[model samples]
Every structure is written in structure tokens, then in C-alpha cells.
Target chain A: MAAADKVDPIHQFQIHPIIPLHIGGYDVSFTNSSLFMVATIVLASAFLYMSTASRALIPGRLQSVSEMAYEFVGNMLRDAAGKQGMQFFPLVFSLFMFVLVANLIGLFPYFFTVTSHIIVTFTLAILVIGTVVVYGFAKHGFGFLKLFVPHGVPGYLLPLVVAIEIISFVSRPVSLSVRLFANMLAGHITLKVFSGFVVSLSAFGAVGIAGSVLPLAMAVALSALELLVAFLQAYVFAVLTCMYLNDALHPSH
Target chain B: MFVTSAYAQEAAPAAAEGDTHAGTAVPAAEHEAFPPFDAKTFPSQILWLVITFGLFYLFLKRVVMPRLGGIIDVRNDRITQDLDHAARLKGEADAAVAAYEQELAEAKVNANKIGQQANDAAKAQAEGTRKKLEAELEKKLGEAEASIASIKAKAMKEVGTIAEDTTSAIVEALVGGKTDKSEIAAAVKSASR
Candidate 1:
């Protein structure tokens, strides 16, 4: 690449090994991504531990936040998966807090975004779909396959309708994983690009320095938007997981 | 080893390198060398993700969720108990009010009954007094009528005596004067009849 092209926007996503380890010729080295994941877990644990340690009748601010998060997921699960689906409250709550903390951690400058990677998001998506499948089969036996068939379809269109339903059902994980991954990736890239413009233009004469304000403003705005997107994506992930679990518990429709 | 310096260096070579060369002198490198897209790191990422997520799930299920649910349950129980206590107090108040009103009504009735009894007793006593006075007056009138009858009889007897005397005297003056008392009395008796 030319020297001007060395200001690579995509370079921000590089995963360098902090502690290189090789096990059975498979590289399971602890990288920046792992560091951020660990950070997310630690931070989440601290928040939960401190907030709930008191268990006060009249909650303080941190306790209120903790309870709000709990009830938010609780209500979502109840609304989407019905009362019976509260059994998965732990899993859904964990996922929401993990993703939310991970995304928020990424907002800090130079911090690695664990959710921006496809592997992490894809694994979470797989876990969700796996739970749905395993529980659906266990709960309903072969009747779970009926999920691919609509109830009120005409006789002639049954096969085609079932095929479409099966395709959409299979696409759930892909859509779920890609939605979070792509959103995080795109938001980071946009932010990096705008910041790059600020740096590149500031290197010019006084005119260039004055013009750099526009990209800086754009970067600021994008950062705010990314923060909102971070929260929204986490919420969407949890809600969709609940919906899929609902399908598992009740596969008739 | 310093991550911040390394990240800064990686992010902006234009500012760090200070406009070293013109456009096309450097080699054309792969711009798409994004580490997240690299398939090699997938295994490590997935491994740590599973481990961390598993630990998190266990922590939440075992420790955090139960505590939160318990706190909420306790608050709800306290609220219900308070409501029941309030309802019991309200029922007590209503009963007390009802009892007070009943007592007030009974007292009013009692007052009216006492007044009626007192008025009836006074009326009976006055009626007895009036009847006693009427009996006394009737007795006095009877005695007075008996005395007047006796006086009238006495006065008639006196007048009859005087009339006999006067008749005897007149006979003496006019004729020879020897009148018998039995004959004079018999004449007075016949004249008075």
C-alpha cells in the first residue's frame, strides 16, 4: 500500500496475542479480544455483586439499576415466552449483561470490541439456537417439526410453505449473529474512518485544520449513535432469544 | 508491550510517520487484513467465550438471581401484610362508629322514655289532687245543706209557737179570755197546714 493508505481504518480490529499459547498445535492464545471478554465479566460481576450485596428494601441507585435490569429481562421473557419460560431467566440475563457490558467496554478508545468479532457473536447465536432445538425436541418430541408447517395454509401450497418456514427457521442464528456483528463492526469502522479524516486533514495547512472540525463533529455524533446501538443490539439479542425459546416451549404455531 | 502506544501507532501512520513519502512509492499491501475476519483466531475466541459465558451463567443462576428474587418477594410480602393491617384497622374504626351511633340512639330513646314517665306521673298526681279537692268540696257542700235544712226546721217550729201565743192573746182581748192550749195548737196546726 502507498504511505497515504497506511492510515488503515480496519487496523483497529486487529487481535494481537497478549499471551501466546499453543495447545496441541491449536492456537488458543489469550488475545486482546479475550482480555476484553474477561474485563466484561469482571465488571459485570462487580456491578451485580455490589448492587445486590445490600438487598435493601428501599434500593439505592446502584441497586435500583440492578433491579431494573433484572426486571427488564424478566418482563421481556414473560411477555415473549410466557410464564413458563422464566426457567431460562438466568441464561437470558447473563447474555444480556455480557453483551451489554462488552459493547459498552468497546466504546472506550483503544479497547477491543469482543462483539465486533463474528466468532463471539456466532457462538452466542449458536448457543441460543441450540437451546431452542434441544428443548424443543425434548419438550415436544417429533411434534417440534410441526413448527415448519403453518396451520391454515391451503393444501396445494403446504409443501412450499413448509419449505419457506424451514428456511426462515434455519436462518434465525445467521440473522441473530450477523445483526449484532455487523452493527458493531460497521459502527466502529465508521467511527474510525471519521477520526482518520480528522487526523489526515489536520496535517494540512491552516485551511485543512479548520476543515477537520466537520469530521470530528461526525465522529462525536457517531460515538453517541454507537452507544445507543450497543444497548439496542443487546436488548434485541435477548428478546430474540426469548422468542426462539418460546417457539421451543410451544411449537404448535 | 504498551497497548495504547501500539494502538495509536497502528491507527494513524499518517500523523505518526509525518508525511514521509509521496503517493505510490510504498508497496501495495493487503488492506483487508482485519484480524476479526481471520479464521485462525476463531477457535480461541470461541473457547474463551464459552468459558466466560459459562462462568457468568453459573454465577447469576446460583448467587445473583435468587437474591434479587428474594428481595422482591420480601417487599411484596411486606406490602400485602401492611394492606391487611390497614383493612383490619378500618374495620375496627367502622365497628366503633356503629357502636357509638347505636349508643347515642339508645340514650335518646331512654331520655324520651324518662320524660314520658315523668310527665305521666305528674299528670296522675295532679288528677289525684283534683279528685281529692272535688271530694272535699262535695263533703263540705253536703254538711252545709244538712245544717240549712236543720235551721229551716227549727225556724218553722219557733214561728209556729209565736203564732199560737199571738192567737191566744187576741182571743183573750176580744172575748172572755179563757183559751185552751190544746185547742189553740190544734187551730194553728190546721191553719199552718
Candidate 2:
């Protein structure tokens, strides 16, 4: 009791059901995580909707922002997957906006971090890989497996190379999901721990308050770094999706 | 494999300490899965994710994409049209300038022609006036000379008569006799000659 209580960084990720409802015996109860997810959708959609609703020939500030988001995602997809990737623009845009807005919304105080969960990130990763798989097979048939075959490997080592390629291909979803999830997870945890250091240190009196400045500054710096990570992870996810779609489009080597 | 076990190890100590800020809120039962990894919540999260994300995707596809893509397309089209218009205007302005310069040069040539004609006319009129004045002066000089010559002839005739008469009178007086008029006349004429 003489010291400040221990800070619980994991507590931030706890999900509390806001509206407990059952749908077809499934626990589809609306939770805080779901609330944030809905919020992400609303915010992203509203921003895109209202900002561009004016559709000014000369875009205003908000319109420019919305346009930039569109162009950013559009360029990323086209660059990674070429013109054919334009077909997947909506999917890629939705995923990018969802992840980005969710990450940013999570950054606010006491807001739920929806993407911090393994399921959500995994589901998103699966959606991308799923699209790539379905489209690959649908478009290329069994030839889609050619992605596992490199063009220049010696015949004797072909088996080894293809095995490696297959493993690498399969690992894409796991890495993709983990990358976004872990980045958001670790960054938030670090930010909280550093902030907790400031809180716990400042509890010890004047000297403690003075000593807490270091951790406070560190937390602030980590926050800026987290903001960068949020945007970067979303970009990584979208770009990777484009590349995967590219592999599907041109399954040779 | 890695995440679950690591989370277990890290969260075990925190759960045992029972010093959690919101007690029993997250780690409800001893067997409750970690909230992030909890299977029970997966269905709900996935369901809601499917529902909300589906809605989000539809919204972006139906509403957001068309509007955003349209605005961008419009702006680009507007920019291209504006540039084309500007180029056209520039071309028109250049044509107008060329025309203005052409008219200016033509006007300069016309003014020079007019000035040359006027200079030639003034020169011709001045020459005619000078020639007319010279002719009048020559005629007046000729008339004055003719009149002077007539007066000189008349004066010379008068002088001859006066000398003859005087000589005749003198001769009569000296001789003291009245001579024949013809003979006196003949002698006087010879003496005067």
C-alpha cells in the first residue's frame, strides 16, 4: 500500500461484451472489440463518404485527404500487382482502411484495439490469401501451383527448391497476420509499460516525480513511433495482398 | 505454439498477483482463455467482423469507391481541359499580336507614301510660281527700254533744228542783205554739216 499499484498492460486488451446477444446459438454477442470494429467501419466510411460527397473539381482539405487515401491505396495496388490488380481495388482499399483506421482508433485513450486480437488479424490475412487462392485456381487452374516452381533451378535440386517455395508460400498468411498483430500488440504494450513507469515512479514523491520525466519522455517518443507502426503495418498488409494477387495473376515462377 | 505459451507464462504471474485493476473482468475463471486467444470469443468476433467488415466492404465498394474515383477522375479531366484551354488562348493571343503588328507596319508604309506625294506636289507648285514671276519681269524690262529709245530720238531731232535756225539768223545779220531762201538754206546746211 505504500507504493503505487502495479500497472496492468494486458488489461487494455480485455474484451467486455457491451450488448450480449445470441444469434443462432452462436456467441455473436457484441463486444467492445466489435464496437470498435463497427466504429472503424463507420469512421472510414463516413470520412470517405462525406469528404468526397462534394466531389469538387478542386477538392477541399477533407476531400484531398480522402482522395489521397484513394490514390495511396490505388498506387500501392497497381505498383505491386499491375493494372490487373485494379479489379481487387475495393477489397484492398477496404482492408487498408479498416486496418489503418482501426489502428489509429486504438491509439486513443481507453479505446479497444480490435486488430490487436489474433482472430481478427488472422481473418484478414486469410481473406487476402483466400482471394489469392480462389482467384489463382479459378483463373489459372492447376497451373497456379506453378508459383511453387522457380524458373532457374537445376533439375537435381528442383524438389528442394519447390519444397522451400511451398513452405514460404504457406507461411505468408501466418507472417502477414502476426506482423500486424504483433506490431500493434508490442507497440501498445511498450507504450503502456513506459507510461506505467512514469505513473509508478511519480507516486514516490518529489524526487520520484523528477525521475519520472525520463519514462514520460520515452512514452511520448514511443507513441510517435507507434503511430508510424500503425500506418506502416496497414501498408505492409495491403502491399502484400497486392503481391499475392500478382502471384495469382502471373503464376509463372 | 509460440504466442500462446509465451502469453501463458507472462500472464500467469499477473493473474496470480490478483492485483489486476479490474478484478475478474478479463481472467474471469481460472480456465478462461486469454482474451485475445480465447476461443469462446472467436466466434463472436468473427461473426461481428464478418458482419461489420462486410458492411464496410459494401459501403466502400458501393458508395465510397465510385465517389472517390469519380472525384479524382473529374479533377484530372478538369485539369487537362484547363491546360488545353490555356494553350488555345495562348495561340489566339499570339495570332492577335501578329495581326496587330502586320496592321501597324502597313499603316507606317501608307503614311510614308502620303508624305512623299505631298512633298512632290508642293515642290511642283513652287517651281511654277517662280517661272511665272521670271516671265513677267522680262516683259516689263523690254517695254521700259522701247519707251526710252523713242524719247532719245525725239530729243536728238529737236537739237538739230535749233542749231540750224541760230546759224541762219547769224548769217543774215552779218551779210546785211536779204538773200534767196533756198540759197541761204543750202549754205547754212553745208556750214552746219
Candidate 3:
């Protein structure tokens, strides 16, 4: 198809079924997104296994990296949620590793970015928010509602502040999901657009080929920036999750 | 520019035809409006996500995380044990040094006492020898003085006898009679004094 040949920047994000299957009239087909997700799991599991296998007192490079990751997330939780928050280390660590690995793997050429999809990012965001709300309610009962009400607010300003707090609280999943999804989507699109410019211009003549250099350079720069963004977005997601959990644990503000 | 623009325009119609063909290939209704925006694929994505995430969570909780935690715990315990062992060794070394110092001090005290005893013994020995030598010298001097006194007495008696004899002979020769021996002795003694 000519559409397939034409450089569609959005084409890279298309979810084609690798194993088309239907279950109960639902399209439960295994897609490229699913494949990459499984790949992420395998990669993450392998890394974790290799790093922890030796368990040396004097850590090797891989073990040190693994330990640093552990402590990095550990410290983030401790700062945001205190000692009591350590109980959720498994969940928080899982989120951090999964997101970080997914983001990193997506950086590879021709790889699908799972986190770039709103559905996927939204699911993760929902999971985080869900955990916070469920645990908050379970732990604090109705006092979890106090999270919407800040201390030291004047009576007249209380309603407006409370409304604003409630709105922001309700929109946590949206903002969290959009932050990651938009970053990846925008970065990937920019990279694709620049790369497409190079291709399109090169098809034109000698002058076009020389002009393509600028876009090629831009693509290279964008890729490096995307790598940084990939790490930063994952970190932001984890940190925000930790903050949300902290709020749940201490519902006073 | 003209050739590139013409090529792009030609590609556009072909792309539109390609889209129609692709649309029909998959059921038109089932076609993803936009792949990411398609609601039809949400269920499958969510379903797989849940399954994968759930399995991953369990794996991390049961296998990976626990192993990591155990490794950290073991390393910490080892570090603590090593520190404790080092402290114990240091304490032992300190005790040994203290004991050595105490023994050294005791030996010094004993050495000093022995030196003092030797000096006193040597002084007493020298004093005894000096006293013995002085007594012997005094006895010899007393004997010599007694002998000299006796000799002097004998010489004085002889001198008196000779003086009486000589006086008697001179008196005879000079037609004078000799005086008594006792009287001559008294006269000689009176003259000598």
C-alpha cells in the first residue's frame, strides 16, 4: 500500500496484531504492544536475576547498579512516605522497574513504546491512583477525605480551596498518564518528523540532499534528548506515585 | 522543487487509494480509527497489562525482591560482625599492653631494690675491714712502747753503776774515799732531772 510506503510519522505507533485472537466476541489479539510488554518483563526479570545471583559483599558493576536502583527507589519512598511507607516497597519497586525498563527499551530503533499509548499509561496511572485511594480509605477510613482540606484556610476560602483540591485529586490519573504519554509521543513524533524530512528532502536532488543534513542533525539531537526524557519521565512517574502514596498514608493535608 | 512537489502530489492519491484498500482488508467497522485512540483494543491491552503486571509483581515480591533484601541483610550482618571482631581484637591488644607495662614497672622496682641491697652490703664489708686493721695497729704500738720503757730503765741502772765505780776509782787515785752506790745514784738522778 502507498500509505505504508509513505513516511507516516504516526505509523510507528500503530498496533498491528502479531497473533490475532478473539475471545468472547472481544478482540484479545496479541499485538506488538503486548509483545514489547512481554519483552520488557523478560528483560527486567533477567537483569534482576543476574544482578542478585552472586549476592557478593563487594558488589560487581551489575549488582551495584541493581543496588543503586533499589536504594534510589527506597530513598524516594522514605523521603515521601516515611518508614511506614516501606511496606509498599514491592509495589513501588515494581512500578519503577517496569516503567524504567519500558522507557529504555522503547528507545531502541524500530521498537514500540508501550508507555506512549494513553491506554497503557492511563492503566498504570489508574493502578497508582487506585492503590492510593483503596489503601487510603482502608487505612484512614473516612478521614481520607481530610486530604482535600488543607489546614489554616480561612472559612471563606475553604470551599474554593477544597473544590480546587478535589478537582486536582480527581484529575491525578489524567495528569500522571498524560505527562508520560505526551512526553514519549511528542518526542517520538518530533524524531520521526525530522527523520522524515531527511528522507523527503533526499529524494529531491543534490541541493535537497545537502539541505537534508539539518533535519538529520535535528533528528540526532532529538534522539539524545528523548533518551534523557525517557529516564526523566519514568523518574517523575515514580516520584509522583510515591507522593500520592504519602498523601494516602498521611491524609492531614 | 517542481519535480519533488509533483512526486508528493502523485503519492497523495496513491496513499488515499492505499488507505481504502487497507480499510476494506480489515473489517471497516473494526478498523482502528486511530490506533492509539481505538476503544476496541483497550480491553486486550488492559487485559494483557493486568496479567503481565500481576505476574511481574508476584515474581518481584516472591523471588527477586526477597533475594535482593536477603543479600543486603547478609552483607550488613557481615559488616557488623567484622566490626565487632575488630573491636574485640583491639581490646585484647590494649589489655596485653597494660599487662606488659605493669610487669615492666614491677621489674624496675625489683631491680632498684637489688641495687640498693648490694650497695649496703659492700659498705658494711669495707667498714668491718677498717675496724679490724685499726685494732691490730693499736696492739702493736702498745707492745713497742712497753719494750722501750723497760730498755730505758735498764740503761739508767747501768749508767748509775758505772758512775759509782768510776767515782770510787777516781777517789782512790786522788786519795779520796768512794761514796755509797745509793748516794751516787741519787746524785746522778738529781743531775739528770
Candidate 4:
């Protein structure tokens, strides 16, 4: 491959298993995705625990940040899912914090993009999708299938509408997984490509050095955009999860 | 009618599409090499789920829930205090209204009592003046009757004396040698009107 066509340094997402234990002919590999997932969980827990340890009338920075996060997730749940949907607050809040921490950690110089991994994203998506399905059944029993039934429609068009509803329902996992995975993969790739340009171009001369400034600037700008996107993707995921939960809670028109 | 053809129509295309993908160049070994589901991690997934669930349940049921409950209780107490304050103010307003009405009723009764007393005193004074005028008129009428009876009595005595003296003078002239004049005077006085 040409040096110009080489994969950038940032494209090098390192993967390592935490516990290198082989058990009974099966490789139960704990990959970097698992490491980051565990780290994200721990970091989130500690931050929240420390922030709320001292409940004060007047909160300092840490407390305020934690409270803001709580209020943000709480308000989002209220807006997307309504007051009746508040029962799912703990699950949704944890998911949001986990994703947020995972995405932010990925922005570090050497870290794995857990959200970029299909297994990780798919796992989370499947969990949400499964929960929605189970909840729908628990809430409405077999009658939950009537969510596909369009009220006051012509009999002839009813079958067609029901088919569309089924397809859309099945597409939930696809859309959810793809949305988070694609965003993370694309952001990391762009950052990698720009950083490579900054390094390779700086070797030429003073003019190359000046030309390198452009890519560096672009990289910086992209990093900021990615950080914003990291927060946004988590928010979107949580919001959609809440929406699916709503469909389960109230299946009627 | 719709079901017979509809199910057939859907299944026909799905079967054909499946065959087409099966004919593709992807190696089957790679697909089989990595098991779609790993049994080893299955236990871990279940374990993690139970652990997270249990931990969260404890936190919520024990710690978080209690703190949240305290916050909610404080909020409720604040609201109840406000409502009690409002109720007390309402009671005060009602009492004020009742007191004003009672005072008005008492004032009306007092005004009526004063009016009745003024009327009673006027009636009594007029009655006293009427009785005093009637008694004065009766006393003047009694004095006038007594004066008239005394003047008539005096005039009758003077007329009797004048008649007796004139008769005595006439008899004395007729009988020139009347020696017993005193007896003639006594008989004329007894027969006088």
C-alpha cells in the first residue's frame, strides 16, 4: 500500500482482554469493549456517589454537575415518556450515563470505542428491544399486538398497514444499533484521517508545516464536534428507548 | 379470502430471496468459525444482570428511595403547612364577618330600645299635662259655685229685713196707741218669706 493511502494513527483502536483465562476449550475473550464498559460503569457510579455523598442545601461544582445530569435525564424522560413513564427512570438514567462515559472515554488518545463495536451496540440495543417487547406483553398481554391495528381504517387497507407496523417494529433494533455504531465509527475515522495529515505534512518544509496547521485546526474542530455528538447520541438513544417504552406502556391510540 | 393468497404471496418472495443470498461468495467457514452465540459468556451475562439488578434494587429500596422519600416528605409537609395557614386565615375571615353581623344586630336592638324609651317618655309627659289641666278646671268651677251660693244667701236676708220694717211702720200709724209693738214684730218676722 502507498504511504499516502496508509491508515491513520487514530484508526489504531487497541483491543485487549482484561482476564486472559481460557476455560474448557472455549475462548471467553474479555475484549477492550468490555474493559471500557466496566470502566464507564465504575466511573459513572463513583462520580454520582461522590457528588451526592454530601447532600447540601448549596451544591458545589461536583454536586451541581451531577444534579444537572440527573435533572437533564429526568426532564428528557418526562418530556419524551410523560409522567407515567417515570417508573423506567433508573434504567434509562443508567444507560445514558454509561453511554456518555463510554463515548467521552473513546475521545482519549489511546482508548477503545466500545460503541463502535457491533457486539456491544447490538447487546444494548437488543436489551432495550427485548425489554420493550416483554413490557408490552406484560402490560397488555396478547392485546398488545393490537397496537398494529389502525382504528377507523378501511378493512381492505388494514392488512397493509399492519404489515408496515410489523416491519417497523422489527426495524427498531437495526435503527438503534446502527445509529450509535455509525456515529462513533465515522467520528473516529475522521479524527484519525485528519491527525495523520497533520503529522505526515509537517515533515516536508516550513510551507508544509504551515499547511499542517490547517489539518490540526480541523482536527481540533472535529474533536469538539465529536464530543458534542457523543453527548447527543446518548441523548438520542435514551429518548428513543423512552419512546419505545411509551408504546409498551400505552398501546392504544 | 385475503389470507389464502396473502400468505402465499409473502412466502414465495422470501424463499426466493433466501436462495439468492445463499448463492453469494461469502465463505461458510468464517460464519461457522465464530459462533453467533457464545455459551461461555452466557453465564457471565446472566450473572452481571443479576448482580446489577440486585445492587440497584438495594440502592433504590434502601438508600436512594429513603433519601427521595425524605425529600418528598419535606415537600409534602411544606404544602400541608401552607394549606393549614390558608385555612386559618379563612377561619379568621369568617369570624370577622360573623362579629360584624353580630355588632350590627346589637346596634339595631339598642337603637330600637332607645326609640321605644323616647316614645314612652313623651306619652307619659302628655298624659301628666292633661291630668293637671283637668284638676285646675275642676277647682275653679267649685270656687265659682260657692261664691254664687253665698251672694244669694246674703240677698234673701236683706229682703226679709226690709219687708218686716215696712209692715211695722204701717201698723203703728193705724193704731196710734199700740203699746205691745214687740209682739207684732215677732209675728211678722215668723210669717216672712
Identify the leading candidate in terms of lDDT: 1
Q: lDDT by residue for model 2 over A146-180, one digit each (tens)?
A: 99998988999999999999999999999999999
RMSD of each: 6.0, 6.3, 4.8, 13.2
lDDT of 1 by residue, A142-170 (tens): 99998988799999999999999999999
Residue A236's lDDT in candidate 4: 92
Compared with the true structure, the alpha-carbon lDDT of candidate 3 equals: 0.83
State TM-scores per candidate: 0.84, 0.73, 0.84, 0.63
Q: What tens-digit string does per-residue lDDT give for candidate 4 at A1-253?
A: 2233333332234333355444565444454445666666667677877776776545678876876776787788888778988887777776777678888988986687667754556667887889888988988999889878868889999999999999998999889978997898789889988887876788798989999999999999999999999999999999988888888887775
Write candidate 4's Cα lDDT for B1-193 as tens digits: 3222333343344335433223221343322111113233433333333344345444544554344435445556878999999999999999999999999999999999999999999999999999899899889888888888888898877776666667667777776665365776677778873
- In the order shown, the candidates' DockQ scores are 0.34, 0.30, 0.38, 0.03
TM-score for chain A, prediction 1: 0.96
Could you tell me how far off, in angstroms, the CA of residue B21 lies in candidate 2 after the best superposition? 21
**Candidate 3 lDDT, tens digit per residue, B49-106?**
8878888889988998888888888899999999999999999999999999999999
Q: With candidate 1 superimposed using the best TM-score fit, by how many Å does residue A50's alpha carbon deviate from the native? A: 1.0
Interface RMSD of 2: 6.0
Q: Once superposed on the true structure, which residue ranges of model 2 sit more than 4 Å away at CA?
A: A1-8, A15-26, A51-64, A78-84, A133-166, A195-217, A246-253, B1-32, B70-93, B133-193
Tell me, per candidate, how large a share of the native contacts it keeps: 0.64, 0.71, 0.55, 0.02
Best by DockQ: 3
Error (Å) of candidate 3 at residue A54 is: 2.1
Native-interface RMSD of candidate 1: 7.4
Better of 1 and 4 by TM-score: 1
